[model samples]
Target: MESYGFIDCKDPKYVDTVKAIERELLFDGLLFRYKNNDDFGEPKSSFTVCTFWYINSLFKIGEETKAKNLFDQLLSNSNHMGLFSEDLDFKTKKC
Candidate 1:
């Protein structure tokens, strides 16, 4: 997919940005939108769309194998009907 911006995917900054996101946002095989306390206090669930976008970014940055593995892991956590909610509990994997 096109980056939709001037920054090339191969650029060190872009790669490093993605790496930083993974380092700070990824948790328990899922991806949290952000860290730190918010109005609701610290986040307790993974933001589904943020995780998907991160997985896509991983693929765009040449981490296809890792992205695929994460994709599968996330998919496996979906409900039996193959549906996902906006948020998923970190421990229970429930919506």
Candidate 2:
């Protein structure tokens, strides 16, 4: 895909940029869309849709193994009925 209008994953600059962006968005290997607190100073948890997008990006960027692992973890976080919540409490491990 790099030859098809995609970023060159093997290029050093692109690789470094990808790593930097990943670091900024991920905490303890979990992805978050944002971390800023509201006016009440209560921060929002990781967004589940953002997490799914992150997993997809990982596969697109050639991190297949890690992406699969993260995808499995994300699935495990779903409710018993196979339902997913929008946000999660990372500390409490609650949805």
* Candidate maximizing TM-score: 1
Q: Which regions of candidate 1 are displaced past 4 Å?
A: none
Across residues 11-70, which tens digit of lDDT does each residue of candidate 2 receive?
776656657757887765566766676775745577778778777767867899999998
Task: Please count the clashing residue pairs in each candidate, in the order shown.
Answer: 0, 0
All-Cα superposition RMSD per candidate: 1.6, 3.3
lDDT of each: 0.90, 0.72
Model 1, span 1-95: residue lDDT tens: 34688788878888898899899999987889888899999999999998999898889899999999999999988998999999999999889
Alpha carbon lDDT at 77, candidate 1 = 86
| Cα lDDT, model 1, residue 28 | 84
